[model samples]
Target chain A: MPTVHATIIARGGGSTFHRKNTCRVLGTPIIAYAIQTCQQAGFIDHVFVWSEDEEIRSIARSLGAHALERPHSMVHYYSGFATQEEWAAQRGRQIEVIAGGPGDVNVAFNCNNFLLRPETLAAMHCQAREDEAVGGVIAVAAVEPGLCLKTRDGSLFPFWNDLSVPRAEHPPLYRRTGVAVTFRERFRNGRMALAPFVVSREEAFDLQHAEELPLAEFYLRKRLGLLDSDRPAAGEGC
Target chain B: MRVTASIIVLERDARDGVRWDARMGGMRLLEHAVARLKGLPLVDELAVLTDCDALCDALGNTLACAGVPVRRLCPTCTTERFDYLTCEESRIRQQLLALEQAGLAGDVHCFGSWRLPLLSTRSWERMYHALLEDRIAARIVPLTTEDPNLYTPLGGDVASGRLFGVWAHPGRDRQEAPQLYRPAEACVAHLGRIRYPQPLTKGVEIAMTEAVTVRTAEDMPLAHFLWARQQAGRACHDSQDGGAGVP
Candidate 1:
C-alpha cells in the first residue's frame, strides 16, 4: 500500500487574521482544526504544515503538527499554483531522501471543515487499495435543489423552486468541497493541485467570513464535547 | 421450547417515528445502524414495533429484504388521532402481558419513539448482557438524547430525553397485574419475589424502587441499567467470595 501523507498549506498572515479566524472556531485556530482532523483520521501516516510566518510555525508545532519552513518567495498571495508546485517538489524530494526510498503519495486537504460522515475515509482507503490509477479520492457533496444550474444566454444560473427540468436531461450536480483533496505520488508535484473530484457542499464548510463562525462552533460542540458547559459564568472572559 | 431474542419499538405517533430527531433534524441519526449491526455475526434476531403503518411497513420491508424477520405492531388509536402517550400505554401493555404469559427465556428490548440516538448492534448485545447481569426488570435505554431539561434527579425537574426499557424474569400469572404508575415502592413490595427466585423484603423493595426511580428520572435506558445490574451482581458475587468488592 502507498504511504499516505497529509500536506497542510497553513496560510500565515496578520496576527489579527489568525486571532479572528481562531475566535470564530471558539479559540481553535482555523489551521489547528485541519491539523487536528488529520491526526484523528486513522489512514493518514504523516502530517506536514507548510507556513512562513513564525507565529504560525510556533502555533503549528505547539499543536503537535510537523511544521515546514516554507520559502518566502512562495508566500505571495497571487503566486497560486506556482507556489504549490515549488513546495511540492522540494518537500517530496526531501521526504523521499529522508526515508531512503520513494516519498509518500501525499493527499492534500483543507483544514477548515469537519467531517459529517467520517466513514468516507474507508471509501478512500478502499479506492486506494483496489485501484492503482485513482490518483486520489476526493469527497463530494450531493447537489442541493437550489444549487442546480441553468442554461440561458449561455450563462450558468442557480436553480430555485418552481424551475422544472426534463428527467432525461437532468444534470448530475456535485459541488467541490475544498475540505478534502488527495494527490498520488506521481501527482505530488506541489506547484499544482491534482484534478480534484467534486465533493458536495453539505460535506464542506468554507469559513471565510465572520458569519460562518457560529456553524464551526456548533460543529465542535456537537461532534466533539470540547466546550465545557460548566465553564466560568458567561460575559466574563469571552 | 427454545426462545430467541426480539426487539420491541414503542412508537406513539408519526411525530415520534423512528426517524424523528431528538437531537437535531433528520431521520434517526442511527437509521443506518441496523445495517451496521446486521454485519456483526454475534446477534441472532432483531425486531421493531411502531404505531404508524407506513413506518412499520418501511422498517418491516427493509428488514425483510435484508432477510431479518421483524414484527411490526400498529397500535390501535385512542380518542385522539396519533395520541401516542395514551395509545402506547394501552397497546404496549397488551404485548407486555402476552409476553409475560408465554414464559419465554429470550430477552425483550423496548425503545421509545423519541429515542433517536442509535446504538451499534454490538452495543445492544453488550447492553443485553449488562441487563442480564443486573437482573433489572424494567428501565429505559435512551437511543437518542433529548433536552436535558426533560430529565430530573428523582425530585428534580423533568427534561425531554429518550428512554428504553428491558424486562427480565417475568411472571406467569397475568391476573394479579399491577398498574403501570404504581409507586415503585408498592410494586417492588407486592410483586417482589413474583419475578425473581427469592422475594425482596419491603425495605429492599423501597431501596430498589428509589434507585430505579432516580435512575429512570435521569433517563438511563433499560439496556444500560441491565448492564449496571450485571455489574452489581458481579460485585455481590465477589463480596460473597471474600473478594475486596466493598469499597
Candidate 2:
C-alpha cells in the first residue's frame, strides 16, 4: 500500500539554446507534455515540476502540477543515478509537508521526454506493487535481437549469444532510455536495482537541438493531436 | 462533437489458409488496429461492428479493459471478392446499419479495419476536423486518396477525386464524370445518418495525402518498411540539452 508519487525535472534554458522545457512544439509547451504524460500514468498521487525559472514554474502550475524552485547549482548538472537519488529524497521531503509522510514509490521523470507511454508508468507502478522488495525500474529500449560485439583487432562475434545461427533463436536486449525512473524510497540506487521497462526506439527520442523542433513537431503531431489546436490557424490560410 | 468511430473488421479464418491476418511489428494486424485506436482522444466511444470472431476474440479483452463501449453489430455479412465496387458498397452499407443500430448519432467517422495498421493519429484528427468544418453544407465527406493508386477498379477518377459514389448518387455518384483522383486512409463522416443511393447533395470532401493502406499482399512489405523507418528515426534522436533550468 505504498503511495506512488512523481517529480518531473524540467529546468532548461529556452528556445534560445534548445534547453528550455518551455520551448513548444505544435502549440503545446514541452513541459506541458511532461505534466500530461504524468496525468495519463494514472497511479501518481502527486505530480511536481522542479524548476528555477518563474515562467517555467508558472506554466507547470498552470498545467496542474506542483512547482518547486530548483537550486541554481543543480540546474546545469547532468542527471543520472546521483541526481535521481537526490531528487527522490527531495520528493520525500515535499510529500512529507503535504501528507506528513513519504510515498513508497517515487518517480524522477525527466523533461525533454515526450515518447514515454502511459502504460509505461502503469507498468512501473505494477512492478513496485507486485514485489515489495523491488527497488527501482528504469526505462529501456529493447534492441531487436541479432547484435554482436567486435574486438579492436576487427573480430566480429555474438556476445554471449548464438543469435546469428537463426534470427528466431535470439532473445530481446535492453538499453537505458535515460528518461524516467521509478523506485522504492529505501533503495534509491536506481542503477543497482534497475528493473528495465522496455521502450521502442520511438519512445527513446529526447530533444536536444533547435533543428530537431520541426521533426519533433511532426512526430508529436502524429502521436498527440498537437495540430488539432491549430485548425483555426490552418483555416485562415484555407 | 462526439465521434462515433466505426472500426470495421472483415471476416478472416484458418479456412482461408492464408495467414491474411499476418503478424507485423510483433502483432497481428487486427491487434495493432485495436491498440492504436485506444489512444485517440477525440473518440468518446468506439463502435466495433464485426461478425469476424477473430477480431472479437483478439480485441474483446483489450477493449473491455480500456472501458470503451463496443457493439458487435451482428448478422455478420460477407462480401463477394470478385466485385470490388459492389463489395465496397456493401462494406459501407454494413457500417451505416451498425451505427444506426448502436443508437449512435452525431459526427460519425468510419474506416476499414485493414486501414487501421497504417493510418496515423494525425490523419484521424484531420478527418474529424474536416467533418466538423463541412457539416453545414456537406452531408458526408468521403475520405479520398490522392493520385498514384486511387481504387481505380471502382472507377475512381484518376483526374479529379471521385470514387464509386457520394458526389451525385452512390449508384452513379459523381458530380462530373472523371472526377478528381484521390484515395487511401479511406473514410467518410456524417452529421447523423448516411443515406446511400441518393445524390451526395451537399458534402465537403477531405483528402488524406498519404498512402497507408493494406489492400493486398504486395502492400504489406511497403507498409512494414515505412513503419520500420519511422520507428528507426524516432530512436535515433539524442538530447544534447545544456541548461541548468531542467524544467
Candidate 3:
C-alpha cells in the first residue's frame, strides 16, 4: 500500500465575503472538522493544513495538524498572478516538501466542508490501493434539473427546458459535493480524471452562506443524535 | 455477498387517492426501485413482486428493454381474515415468502414502491453495510414537523405509537409535551432468518433517513426540494467542470 497524507486547503475564505478557516462550527474550528476526518482515517499517515493566514495555520497546529503556509500570491483571488498551473505547483510543492517524493496518495481536502465523513476518504484510499491504474476519486452527488426557470431579455423561460416534467423522467444528473479529492502522481497539468465517490445527502451540504451556519448546526446535532425526535405536526393532534 | 432487491407493488383502492405506482419528478416510483436495483453491482437478481397487473406488465416491458432479467410473482394465501392490520402484515409476509420461494436466495433488501423516489445510493450503502455487520437493520424515517416542538408524526399509524422519549407515542400526550417519534422502514435483512412488516419486530435502532422517501401527500414538497438540491449540485458540477459531467 502507498503512503497516504492529507493536505487541507484553508485559504480563499480570507476574503471579505466568506468566513475564515478559524470560524467555529459545532465546537471546533471549521478547519478542525476537516482535520478530524483526515486524522480518523487510519490509512492516512500524516495530516497538514496548507493556508496563508497565520491564525488559520495556528488553529490547525493547535488541533494537532502540521501547518504549511501557502504563498500569499496564490490565495489572493483578485491578484490574478497565480494561474491554475502555479496553484497546482504550490500545492504539489507543499506535498513534496511535507512528505517528499510524491507520496502514494495525496488528498486535496477543503476546509469549507466539515460534514465530510472519514469513511469517504477511507473508501477512496481503499479504491486507490486496489487499482493503481485509476487516476483519482472525488466525491459527487447525483442531480437532476427537472423543472427550473431562468430569465433572459427580461423574460423568464425554462432553464433545463424540461419544465412540467416529473423529476423521475429527468435525465441522470450529478454534482460534486466539494468534500475532498484523492489522487496519486497521475494528476497531470492541473487535471486528473476522477472516479465519482458518491456521498450521502447530509455530507453533500457544505457551508457557504451565513444562514447555512444554523442549518449546519442543526445537521451536526442530528448526526450526533442530539436532536429530539418526538414532535407532532401542526394542525394535527394538539 | 449476494444481494436480492425486491420491489413491492400492491393494488390499493383508487378511492383512497394514492397512486400505487405514482409518478414523482419524471418517473414512476417503481421505475426508481428497479433502476436502483439494477445499479447495485452486488445485487445478483431483481424481483418485482405484486398482485397488481399494471405493475407486473409495466416492469416486464421495462426490464426487457433494459436487458435485465426479472421475476414477477402474485402472492398467494387467499385465506379470508378480519382485522385489517393482521391481514396486512400476514399478506406482506406471504408476499415475502413467495418472493423468497422464487429462488431469490441470500440477503434481501425490500423497498416499498412509494419509497424509491428519493432514496439515494449512499443510504443503500449504509443499510447494506449495516446488514452485513448485524442480523437485522432498518432505515429510520426522518421527518420534519411543521413546528420543531411538535411530535414528528407519521401519516399511517404503522408505528406501535407506544414509544417514550425519543420514540414518541401519539396516544401518550395530546397537546402538552408533544412526544417525539422515529418511524423506520425495514430496509434490509438476511432473508433466511428475518421478514419485515409494517412495525419492525424489536430492538432495532432508529437511524435518521439518510435518503428521504415520498410516503405521504405532504412529502411532495420535500421530494421537489430534494430534486432541487440535486439540480443545484449538478449546476455546481457543471460550473466547476466547465459544463462537463465528470473527469
- Per-model TM-score, in order, reads 0.40, 0.41, 0.47
Clash totals in order? 31, 25, 22
For model 2, the chain A TM-score is 0.71
lDDT of each: 0.39, 0.51, 0.53
Better of 1 and 2 by TM-score: 2
lDDT of 3 by residue, A1-238 (tens): 6777787778746442365566666677777788988899777787878788887888778878888888888886447888766877877787677677566677777665678788877886776555444466656544434212212321112233242344455544444444444565666434454555666656766554443454455567667775432321111000
Off by over 4 Å in 2: A14-17, A78-95, A144-171, A179-192, A224-238, B1-247
Worst 10 residues of 3 chain B by lDDT: B144-153
Query: What would the per-residue lDDT of candidate 2 be over residues A1-238, giving only the tens digit for each residue?
Result: 5676677777657523544577766667778877888888888877877787888789878978888777665665453334745765765676677656766677777665666777876776676455544466656553333222333432222232341134234433343444544455547544334455556655655554554454455556557554432121111100
Fraction of native A-B contacts kept, per candidate = 0.00, 0.00, 0.00
The top-ranked prediction according to lDDT is 3
**Which sections of candidate 3 miss by over 4 Å?**
A12-16, A131-133, A147-149, A161-164, A188-191, A230-238, B1-247
